[model samples]
Target: MSTVPETGTLALPPLDGLGQLLPRLSRRWPDRTALVTDERTLSFADLDRESSRVARALQDRSIHPGDRVALFSQNRWEWIVSYHAVLKAGAVVNPLNVMLTGEEVAYILADAGTKVLLASGERLDAVGDELRAVPSLEQVVSFDDCGHQVEQFSDLLAVDDDPGFTPFPVDPGSLACIAYTSGTTGRPKGAMQSQRSLVLNCAYAATMHGRTSDDVVITALPAPHVYGNVVINATFMVGGKVVLRKRFDAEDTLQCIVEHRATLLEGVPAMYAMLLASPALEDADLSSLTRSTVGGQTIAETVIDAWESRSGVPLIELWGMTELSGLGTTHAIHAPNVRGSIGVALPGVQVKVADTQDVTVECAPGEPGELLVRGPIVTMGYFNNTEATAETITPDGWLRTGDIATHDGQGHFFVVDRLKDMIITGGYNVYPAEIERVLIGHESVALVAVGREPDPVKGEVAHAYVVLAPGQQPDADALIAHCRQHMAAYKVPRAVHFVDTLPTTSSGKLIRRHLRSSATANA
Candidate 1:
């Protein structure tokens, strides 16, 4: 009964070649500001020319069509340029998280079979050894001239543009990027996205958000993630200007929003919490912002009410995942009928609830079940992992989103929880099993269960319930130190509660849900 277009059958323009699209959009916008970082501003024309130059440089390095090039850097103008350059050169872009450990980096590079990596100088040290370890990576390009072994990114731009290099012809279904999602099992699997998937998602997001050329978007999320990628793509689709921040700093975010008069903002719930708690929230001139959107995790009604009261702007909630290309459901700002619900499915998307048997079920008003989504925006499949692909995507093409949700009679949906035991801390997914496996190896830990504990800013923080071996004891500080030595800093527990025994089922399997509930209640 929704007026929006039908699911999976929307007639979208064919997006066969991203290389051609960027140039054409540049011509249309011409002098319009396309990107603005802390240090520089690039107009559409500048982006076109520079990206072309970078594309030619990529070709000079033998990065040909279909090659996968990893981009490991923070949010910066260079990151944008690199993204366009890779696409223009007909290579797939694999953006790596700056926070990932060397082992994780090696796993991704080896898994994706990446040929080259473009990294910031500061991040080079973290992955230098890993890059060397992976024989498939032939070259390393650095954004800064650090007198290192890596090629300078600026030097690449100085290369003469190749006039004869024709843009490669590609089908809309050809792979565009392989975004890796942290797997519940072992290693992460790359969610293979097509050219159509990426382009259509951006267009749809822009349309849903009512973005215009006059809109100024401030992005605090890291570009390596799908959320940041979608925001950048959407902004460009509408010829909107973007203000990039390398990292999220509450005070700096306030200053940037005020100074740039940012009209739109995309952040996670933690960011909003920080901004609201900061002293600058009361004094900063945030009047320029007309829309503020939060996603990656849930937003409490209390936080929403407080933010709306202070900023005089409603906070829109979005529900999406990396596999969905960064948008599935959004709370439309202008919708009068469905106010609080994650607005009706975006154009060309279909949502249904399924029982444990995977059969579609109609929720009578407020009943919650597993949320299943099917659409063009959904990923083609997990790259190189047929088993995972089969598990996530049905034979009929519906993608099992693994989240629990309920819908009102009016068609508005509300997400309840995720089926996977994944923790979303500070907007980043942290799997407890991964951390528990590492913790149990510690000399002081006999049994350990990692779970989520409620936090004011992050919504949930990693909490560890540890039981030491008999006659052996490790303090909270020491156990935390041990975790930091074994895993990424964010994966380390923010708080460790010493316990005598961990709750387990009759079969001797650890019951993580009970541990999580106990930890939250006691916290």
Candidate 2:
């Protein structure tokens, strides 16, 4: 399941903060376009100025050092600027998932005690009411025109160039961001990450990915997430131009790569599959793309073959998590995907496969067990959830990654089944426990179990099984529609099944495997 070690790990030298690498890039690469969008572009120098302006805006709102600033917006140049500004101001940036419902967002804002929020238009409306109710939230700014009780992003920039902001001293372990990750647990726990941790990952990516100032990157992931943060920030650190997209559309992403002469394309397996499915891919001039970093779950062999055959670029697969600042094991440069291998641990990261009975014992090669990751890139811990954090990270500094993987003695790794019941559908992480909890709220359901069903397109989707109450009879469409009102769209179960009784252990714990087997039989 593992492959030979990669050509480079984190051979790249370190910097203080992730954004600290920017000023130097701007100074050296002055007029080069630092970021590109469909409608606007920002040069290296412009990015510095914009970041300064954003920092000043936060200061004007009385944001203090170490305060949390929630960035509840989609991808845009401003999003990048806000990231730099928040860091410069010595405040932690909480990148809110754009997919979460308003209530879910409000919960995070309240938990993080966010003072200032930068949101996109639709995002503003989605969370406006909840945001207004959060007393800790002092100000709100929108990147686009929205008739909300908030300041316009453009108006904030009209100040007489005197942003009056200064960079604050930062420690390697100082809290830099609180990225909320919904794992197998029903609730989203904020993973506390530091500036040093993120910058280390970015620097490592910049070195290992072979990026240069002339390189142009096309991103196919959500920017608020850690993966997108690493790709976008790493590209910036390498003084490359970023072609930012609000959403990942196969045709649009491919067209942008060709038009911009992008040198790198980064995405998850679902994204690669979608790109391969694109009609434009057959004729699109993709010579500009040198390689593609396949993030998230390892891709299927046929999909990888199709992508290599179609794009003529190597789909370099890597394994990582939000806790690890977005990178872990990646293949050696130009190394082929050998039998679904995720490759060895990246530079600066120490990985081991431990036995289930005794974590102290390392698993032999090709033997599936719990995967443990250790590195500076790992999160400090979960915010305000010390118990969960304590459970995840051993006192000795190793993080129980909660993933089932195997590693060969030569420093290679391969994924087995997931140790956690988190389903990845269309590149989105969907925790079955979260969906199951929500479904249990339905009055018609006496009991419920949620599991993943194999999907040809999305990879896998949530499939919920329900046993109705004695007299109540609920329809599938209605139950699904109800879930839409409670959770994000991507989290809604793709299909619903009604059963007389669900299989369970003698101790009364619902057996998900039995349900999965039944689903397979029915399919």
Candidate 3:
């Protein structure tokens, strides 16, 4: 192990606000389409005006700067406006996952101490009676008429001018947003993101992806996750027209690309798989799709090849986390990626693998170790969780990404697996991603996930859960044999279970914890 010099923080300009991106574009391309949904299309100027009105309305409700504002809505123009408006008011925007139930939503609201909530009717329905118990929640605004003291969204936009409203004192260091992790490991930790981090990330992404103003972007991922948060801001900053969808439908997503002549597609592995499986793909004209980005999960090798071949677009695998304000590394637009590598770190972002005990000591090239990243995109800390913050960020100022990874001399990175997800069998460490990456290449396997199975002698053993391709006969022994052929006997899974589908988060990240719990329950 060797110690690599930590990339020190830069002296950046005061970002002041997260909502500043759209306004700049509104001035430059006021007439260009900024947001598109099934219900409506909004130009840059329109988005600016509406978001400002929302800010003024929020101000009218006595919501002040530094307060917490929750946005619980499906992907819509209103949701986008509400996000910017909350930031413009200098309040922290807490974007809630649409799939979360009422109880889950209430827990976050109470924890975040959100004073105001802007929810769509559908989202409100998901968290109906549970919200009434939140004493800290003072106001609730709905997109449509939902009773129980919910104010209408249209009413907030009735007055456009803000003569009496005064902009709050905000700085680059202001806590702009709190993006909560999915809590697959434990209770969700709110990652505190600064205004400067958000702005800088947009520029970083634009450079990494070589995005231009002419690109038409399809935001297929949910608006709440970290991936969506950064993608939306970066796409807008690049002056790309965003097509927002409430939920992903493979056919609809492909059609939208053709209809809007979308140049970029953003989604997780599952979404890409569905898009590749879309019957319309065979005949559709997807020449407009120049780039497709995938992350937040392990992508199947076959799925990657299928999408790229069918659409004639390259699938750029990316690596990021909520703590990084979104991304840390990506494949350069014109550069070829190493087979197992995610790509080089973005400009101003430094990534290095380090020994588990000492973050200062770097791992040898091609050796798997914890990845430590230092960049403007890294978060301030976990909100209200000082212990976790201390545990995650090294004293030398590197955010200890819990994912295990390796990089070659050329700077290409390969995310092996989550540190927490590492399985110890017979005193040897096994990474599920390595096994899954190998298994996914098999002809019969469509999707495969590896989990830790309890074993009496070895302490724990690997178990494979696979979903076979359509019409293929279930053959667990064949897969086990395949693993044995490619990997050492100890690293191969002891048993295999065939399933209809594997569990995943909205972003398509395989939730191994869920499978582990199920394995325990079954055992």
> Which candidate wins on lDDT?
3
Q: At residue 382, give the lDDT of candidate 3.
A: 89
Can you give the lDDT of residue 401 in candidate 1? Answer: 83
In the range 1-523, model 3's lDDT, one tens digit per residue, is 9852222221224346667665666666788887899899999889888888998888888988889999887788898999988988888899888778788888888888999889998778777799998989998989978765789999989867754444455788779888888777678888999988888877777778877777789987777787887788777776777899888888888788889999899998778765654566777789888988988866766678877888777889898888988778889888886554678898888899999887888999988889999977789998989999999987878999988988887788888889999999989999888788778778787777899878999998888887776668888889988888888888898888887777777767788867755445444
Pairs with steric clashes in candidate 2: 6-332, 9-347, 10-347
lDDT, candidate 3, equals 0.81
Residue 385 Cα positional deviation in candidate 1, in Å, after optimal superposition: 0.5
**How many residue pairs clash (N, CA or C atoms closer than 3 angstroms) in each of the candidate models, in the order given?**
0, 3, 1
Tell me each candidate's RMSD, in Å, in order: 11.3, 11.6, 6.4
lDDT of each: 0.77, 0.78, 0.81
Off by over 4 Å in 1: 1-14, 162-166, 337-340, 422-523
- lDDT (10s digit) by residue, model 1, range 1-523: 6563211222324557556656766656778788888789998878878888888888888999899999988888898888888888889988787766788888898889999899998888766776678878999899987767878998988987655555566677788888887544589899988887788777778877778777889887877787888888788776788888888888998898888899898887557755765777878888998888877755555556667788877788787887887888886567753444566787888987777464455566677677888988889888789999998898888888887677887768876656666788888867775677566656566567777778999888888897665567668888888888888887888988876556543112356667855555545
Give candidate 2 regions above 4 Å deviation: 1-14, 162-166, 334-339, 422-523
Question: Lowest-lDDT window of 10 residues in candidate 1?
Answer: 4-13
